[model samples]
Target chain A: MQERKRTEIATLGEFGLIKHLTEGIELKNESSKYGVGDDAAVLSYPDKQVLVTTDLLMEGVHFDLTYVPLKHLGYKAAIVNISDIYAMNGSPKQMIISVAVSKKFCIEDMEELYAGIQIACEEHNVDIVGGDTSSSLTGLAISITCIGEADKDKVVYRNGAKETDLICVSGDLGAAYMGLQLLEREKAVLRGEKEVQPDFSGKEYLLERQLKPEARKDIIEKLAQMNILPTSMMDISDGLSSELMHICTQSKVGCRVYEEHIPIDYQTAVMAEEFNMNLTTCALNGGEDYELLFTVPISEHEKIAEMEGVKMIGHITKQDLGCALITRDGQEFELKAQGWNALSEKNN
Target chain B: MQERKRTEIATLGEFGLIKHLTEGIELKNESSKYGVGDDAAVLSYPDKQVLVTTDLLMEGVHFDLTYVPLKHLGYKAAIVNISDIYAMNGSPKQMIISVAVSKKFCIEDMEELYAGIQIACEEHNVDIVGGDTSSSLTGLAISITCIGEADKDKVVYRNGAKETDLICVSGDLGAAYMGLQLLEREKAVLRGEKEVQPDFSGKEYLLERQLKPEARKDIIEKLAQMNILPTSMMDISDGLSSELMHICTQSKVGCRVYEEHIPIDYQTAVMAEEFNMNLTTCALNGGEDYELLFTVPISEHEKIAEMEGVKMIGHITKQDLGCALITRDGQEFELKAQGWNALSEKNN
Candidate 1:
């Protein structure tokens, strides 16, 4: 055994660790046409069209152990995995969870986690089939794998969007990210005041959005109901601009998001102004919204615009046009994606 | 944050840690009638048959870093996951892997792991669809979720074995366990001798079995080719006798295994004798062979017997009669399953 000085992981950044960890993955399975390099991995199953997506959430990195409930963590883990599945335009059917824990957590904590997981399962109507459990050397870490089914025709790829397609996003933005900010602020107060009640008034919606953000299964169902098939789709886990840039690079298309069209929850808007942060920047770059972002032919814009859950944000453009955000005054600035790049993202 | 004295997990044993971590799990998915409470979880998918399987291997726990080549570890991890699919009598088509690594492991080590994974994927014709990567606080922990397909009529359950059915196992018994024993002994010798090269003559097969185990996907295929579906089946990861006992318990049937009929390779037999360990104990309780153990009706027994890669060991009996092992001299002793209960079995 070789003994060496241990270096803190923070110094390497998340991307560096991912790069370091996945450095030697050689795809041996024919089904693995793509692995570890995209939003979701592709698999070719015999006689069936299938998609598999996975996400891992670690305590402290993904959530604050103090303010976030364990049950919510479980629910969020399942939702995020499903988010990837939804991004593929597939209906999720099953999930398997693997958890690693240390002594600090108790059976009660696991119960809460399961409670949230169960709630998500009931809401999504997916089965909780199996999972693995082990003790971690540190805090908690969870890996959830979601199985989804889609017809070969219905499955959408990140690269499928074409120039001139109408860009749309479901639900509102900035709420979840702002909620996280509020929760963190509350945690700071709770740390100082031994017996003070948290000021939760006026921030309930945003806080709930952050703590219990739901995947767009309803939007997925709604899209099906409307007989609308997006040319391309993705769930908003990273900020709006980041996901857009992904679409831009992958689809070989650019986009122009109108600033006025970006939806920000009222509380999120106020919070952003209170914090001296730009509302548009928070909407454009804040993450964990769990909303669906999709694109359709320009002909479908009026049809999609009337929908209850979706909002039109931009239009895809030619490659040379580049991705940009247009202000209410009509000034356009080049869009830079600030999505949580696992490579350099700082762990909270 | 609450600060506490650090406690070494080794003091708790594997079972204690699993119990501590899983105590709070709540199964909310209607399809998840069971989770973390059975050998394999049952999940009902909409418009599809139940998809199932598992996998998790920790470096220090399942493999030693020094002698275990990185390629073998990667390949072995894939096999173990694929083996779970085989145990369900399902055709594994895709898998997602999540890996946690410490900086101590280099990029070259990761490449070695992926190389092995690729080899297994090619051999199995499965896909390395997707996976996640992160830095570990300590040792490497690898987990894989394998997805497979099965016809409703062909799916096997551990609870389906019946009384009077023939008990069967594929390939040799105890070889992997014996191989592990041989490697441990060699490691011990090297640790003590310092300058001496470990002896390798007459130890090749056993060592290979330990370092590189195969998933019996071939056996599943061959069984299907012979049109012989097992009444029940599971992989031999926790030892042959224990798996048999599980089949007995789950199926509510007893079994009588013949010591003379248990397949033993020449290398395993010799090593048992050399180590002065009971060959019967090794074959009965040794685990990690990744072979299939199943049963067929007495009438179907002949059909299975004629197939290549199968050995009939015993017959399933009535539950009241109980499970037992018959000696070469006709002495019948009760068989108590000594499976590796990761949830409760102390490593010691």
Candidate 2:
């Protein structure tokens, strides 16, 4: 053996590291048509069509231990990752979980975490196919990748939203955000005056909306049953304004959402008022609700209106029209694209 | 609005958590035939073979910051993850990488990490498809699920090894472990006991092997050229013994390895002696070599020997015969299955 110099990883840029690592990888499976370069990796089983997507959840940034229950956290992790598949109009079939925990966690703790994961899997009827468990030096990390299948003709892409499409959202907006606000406030109250029991009694729905957000899997099924194909679909994670902006950008169109029509849950509305915050602000900028935000052809508007839990909020327009919001006061305003930039910001 | 009780994830085990989290998931696409319940999730793409495999690397367990360069670390992340797919006799197409970083780090440091990842991707000719990024309070984590493809007939699993199959390893073992020893030595010298400019000049190969190991993509290519289908295959990640055990367990057979046949690079051999450790132990238990450990039927032995960089280390036997190692000194010893357990202890 001869001595050779090795360069450190820091010397390479992010792009450089990825290039060097994946080079010379040859795909020999006829079933793996695409890998590693798209929004989702594409895999073809012998008898099925599937799109795969994965994401990682880090403690602190994605959730807080102070208020989040381990079970809810587990459930939320599954919903978030599965949402990506649903965004593509795919039926989620299975998921693979990987977790790294610190020694501070015991087997009992891990069991709790998996219980939440199992609950989500069962609700969705997906199996806990495979996973890797490792011990970390600090905190906890969870990575999940989900596979979903859709008919070739029914699968929708973020680019499919067209001008004149009706933009809709299942369930109300901003409830999750309001719930988070209340949680933060309660934490502050406990930390400061040590007075009041957080007064969460009246905020059950909003709190549940935040702690255990669902992926709107039912809505996806409903759409299929009604023979409706969304022009574009995405989960409302980073607030309505931000998600709406994403739809506009990805679809190369503009959107106009009516303020009065923007559905706000009753509990979220009450809580926002109690907190002395604008109801619209909470709805527009709150992230992590996991509700489905999608667009449909205008011809289906009447049909959608008759469906339960579905609300029509806006319409798509030509690119030059730009994204806007018609306020309750009859004032029109431009929609900003900024959401929670988790990386650049310190405080949420 | 009413306050609801917070659920603690610790109450649910990892399995329970997984179940809870996956509830209510609906599959909308016909393409998603399978998800979350098998060794690997299945995706169906037209006219393409399926890609698959997984790995999760935790901080502190896999590397020591005192010696590993960030660039090498990043590249190694991709290399290790992709090795799983390779072990399955599949061509890696792309990878989805998800990382959990602590708040102590900045974007610049992350970019440094990604730089190494980029370099690795380029070398492997893989695309930087999609991944998730988030922050942790401390310690960094990376989970990679690789998508790959192989002709149905060419794919190999651990269960395929049979009686009389020749067990082989590509390149060498124990070098990476020795490299770690040398680097630790140099690090100790630099930390204290002045004037000890360590004689690290001649130890570069071992260090690089430890720090920036490469996956056996070349051997995979060669196997295709020679039209060889391995009876069983796996990457030498947790050491040779551990991998062999996987094959033995899965194939329901035993193995017999000859001590004299195991290959050890010159530098690794010397380092093993200097450390007052048996060179054989290093070869058997030292990990992270990232080489291919595979089995072939006796009929293919001659053809395998003709290939470059392939070395036969052992042979498979009937289950009742059991796994054993015949030492060069004519001492026969029973082989036990043991290696680093990620959920328990990582010797590194």
Candidate 3:
């Protein structure tokens, strides 16, 4: 918490505000022919297949600003869309952002958000081509459309998995879900109190996982360097069980995931225990990990096992076999998709 | 309005609702490689330069649901994005839509919205590539991103206007603004009463202009057929005066527009008189026209004059003359940007 001077956004008009925020931005991608200050952004994807993905984050629905810093919110929002590009085995090139905010926000607040977005774009080598900024009647709303490029034959789809393909995932899961739980607890503790800071000494990893998660760009690069083309690929955003089901349904196949082999961080396990929840269930259905999940031919199993930060947790099965989880006790159970459903949540 | 069945959105869930809305939407453009049911939409533009643009429409700030039907809202949202592509001298090829809605909306309501989107896409020959749908805490929020393609040398930008270039606009101005005024007046009349329909006889054109606007695709096609290229172009979303200012400021040039030449429909003039508002002011500052305002070489003035649906209002001037409007009574006034400012409105 730092005391700073706030400048009203009304001081600068809409065009003036857009110009002020995007003034110093320079296009860094060759595909980006024209950046801001135009009716539409011009791009040139001469020989590559263009990829487009969009995400909308709404206040109180997708996020709670009470515990989420504005910078981290911006960072996470960009990461969410970028992750979708990588999920299709593409290199992100340009982004168009549109935001609507109430008068509660000032120019400085917007600067912080754009700073986070700039950091993410610079790191990923994506250009901020164009965006629209306007006033909203309620809290903040952000909608981002990310464009990427992939070779004609390199793009992967979820319907490519076949029987006997090995299922693998990069990095561990459930940490981000654990982080959210901890944040909610801390927010509740400080609800009616003033000057009493909540303790979060050893749970820093959880908070970082929730607030500032990064897209799995390195994993995409590593797979390319290893020359391993996945049969099917997607990023794990809505929990492993839900995404796996999508692959199974689309590919017309089934899978058997090993409960014992599911990746879980130590911090996530500790937090799940403290909350008296099942760690395995958390790993399977707790989402927002932004980890790459894919399947390759079983012949490449040895190479996949050798790759650092990746783990083989299952294998594709025939359509009649059904998707299941093989427990450590040798019992098999159907995997239910209990992932977070924003629409369904409204009914409750 | 006819009575229709409404299904609860929660029953279908997010993914199910998306699948239901986007089912049977085949890709219509050759550039659209893969669409819907994937992490990202895939497109290919081998020789054409790609154009991208986005717009965010927030409830209450952008539209009033009480007076606007869901179908018209969706249609306008799509057109607003598509118009930007046409403004760039490109043909729209693909679109990605993201919407956030409160629980008050039902599955049938979304279908009506998507039906309008489908009609717009089909008419433009653009493909509905992909979209994200989530629940909002309040009213509806829509964000649409349109992708288009044009020849390498044909893309137009606002900064390309040069000295002595003739300024022209497609269709009529101020009708849409007048339509909005009529809708608001009717809404106020019916505020506390039921079954008392506010009469809008002899004003159907204005109502249509505000509810459903079409981009000037015909003008672009006609220009191409005539082998004419505008030096600069942009769609009129934020009033003619404000958009003209952008062209002048970006091109580092000035212009003199004749008030007598400004195009106005007969209906708009009558409505202006009824509202007791200045007719020229309404024509100059009224926004959401969605018409193409552009500058072509003076050498082609003869061909332009022969062109139907286009009115030549003025010509670009040297940077020293400044942007001004010459009245019919032989008076000159520096044009001011009194366009609708959503951000400024928040302060009031």
Candidate 4:
């Protein structure tokens, strides 16, 4: 490996640093008429409804720098917002990222973070249009706002689901949550031993799910090709149970999800067993999966069943039925959202 | 005053708290088709271009709570972002506010902050659309993104100034910076003396300017009514001299601003004299005025002079001339940007 060069941010000042960081950025989206260096980014989206979503991630609260690489942190931050845009069945076109870092970070650290952000934008064909960078008193803080566009008639909302709509989910769940657990356990063990290495053999999938999850743009493209528009949709960041509750409450309906139909990767299942946890419980309530959970008309169930990476989990029901899960033994129980609640767990 | 009710944020959880805070937010912009309670906010500006800007405010680095009230902090945070939209000569339509607070804040504390934000939004005709709230490990963090719209041909940029164009400013300068100095002095004095109240009896204008600065939307509207499109425009958040340098550098031009032409309020001059500082220096380099700075063709000088609160202070010059200020004593001096560079000042 080559030696890396470092520069102090103070030398360039705020304006100079911003200019340096965004020097070679090329706007890929036609909608991005003007980007950095302007008072505000100028965009044009003719005849389309624009979608906007924002997410804020703080150090110590959202990630542990001891285990999370700055590049991965940057990538995950952008993807998280992009996933929200995708959840509305919109295509992300531009993003504005604001970051605040303490003196502990050098210019090289910011470069690595921006590199990761650029990679994610390039992969999604999105434009890095504008941002604000400042200094924090303690740790790094990142906030991303993604702008997307969709045809006015095709955008999906959480309140559009109807009774008898088939519930579907793309990809597997709980891997990211289990990956977080694995990293935490390793961090704890390494605290006592100087030379101990994390034992991550055969668990790259879980780690990837946690460190580098991608938004389900391919799934959305496939759905469009299949001529299926989800009645309602949302991304699963706060666990399946929690997101399901949001859709149900917004649509004024309930759902019946089958425990066996919930997809779980082998590594997640093995890790659950090692930790003496129920696989079904983790699949239902573990968060940070970044998977698409949506409801389609029951009449299109056959078409969805033929698609790859999508599973038919259950069906929507009237409000009186409540959100519940039918177990393998045919026992029905009300689902509780045990996802991370920042206010109740950390602030209060 | 009636006693206010207090509630713990933990009791309502994150979702419930978001609902409570945004309970009656009504979208008044035609571009805002959908707001809050969705994966993303939906907007449409079919025949116009959209402008977006973001700003981040971190505790300790940006504001000191000992002297800055939470309501004022929240209001300033929103105005700062809105100012950027006006700087682009666009009409702000919507904003998304994201805040991260520590355990020390109660539900009522958040209510106060939101009230300030709501007031700003209502006054500006901008709707609160979508945002994310999380818990921080330490002090408060606020990030606001403002979305605005303008006709593609009417949007002004900082690189359009031409030689001989008359530079103009809306309102006076240095009052906000002087106000900040006063507050800092009072905070230092009150640290050791328990009974000393800040003697702000005659300095109400300075305190209000510092605590509740407003974006110059009125200036933009008036300029439109006058049919005088500025060649280049930007808000004076980082002092007149610094922002002038930005315009000069970007437009490949230089400027000669007359010392006597710079506008300074009476309170600002008195405060500078009391502090043994040069009034001209404060007017040139003191920041956070939230005033509009623009240049118009020399032919429109008479019209600009007739407008209320408008002052012509300078004229654009060739790049070879360099950016300078002609003092009242018949001497010229180069301008330096002494604006707030948080990275160098606080973190370093």
Candidate with best DockQ:
3
Candidate 2 per-residue lDDT over residues A132-203, each given as its tens digit: 666567777788877666675766766678999999988888888888888888887787564356668978
What's the CA error at residue A20 for candidate 1, in Å? 38
Once superposed on the true structure, which residue ranges of model 1 sit more than 4 Å away at CA?
A1-48, A103-106, A185-198, A328-330, B1-50, B182-201, B270-276, B300-308, B329-331, B345-348
Docking class of 2: incorrect
Q: Candidate 2 at B312: error in angstroms?
A: 1.2
Rank all candidate structures by their TM-score, best first, as comma-separated numbers: 3, 4, 2, 1
Please provide TM-scores, in order, for all candidate models, with all chains considered together: 0.80, 0.84, 0.99, 0.98
Candidate 4 accuracy as TM-score: 0.98
C-alpha positional error of residue B308 in candidate 3 after TM-score superposition, expressed in Å:
0.3
What TM-score would you give candidate 1 relative to the actual structure?
A: 0.80
How would you encode candidate 3's per-residue C-alpha lDDT over B1-348 as one tens digit per residue?
Answer: 779898888889999999999999899789999999899999999999999999999999998899999999989999999999999999999999989999889999999999988889888998999988999999999999999999999999999999999999999999999999999998888898988887889999999999999999999999999999999999999899999999999999999999999999999999999999999999999999999999999999999999999999999999999999999998999999988787886432
Model 3: per-residue Cα lDDT over A283-330, one tens digit each: 999889999999999999988989999999999999999999999999
Worst lDDT 10-window in candidate 3 chain B: B339-348
DockQ agreement of candidate 3 with the native complex: 0.78
lDDT of 1 by residue, B54-162 (tens): 5556655567877788889888888887787788787776655666655465545565677788688778876554555555556777777776666756767788998
**Candidate 2 displacement at residue A225 in angstroms:** 1.7
Writing each residue's lDDT as its tens digit, candidate 2 over B80-158 gives 8677777777767666666666555444455566778767776766554455565556767777777666675666777
**Share of true Cα-Cα contacts across chains kept by each model:** 0.05, 0.38, 0.84, 0.81
Which one is best on TM-score? 3
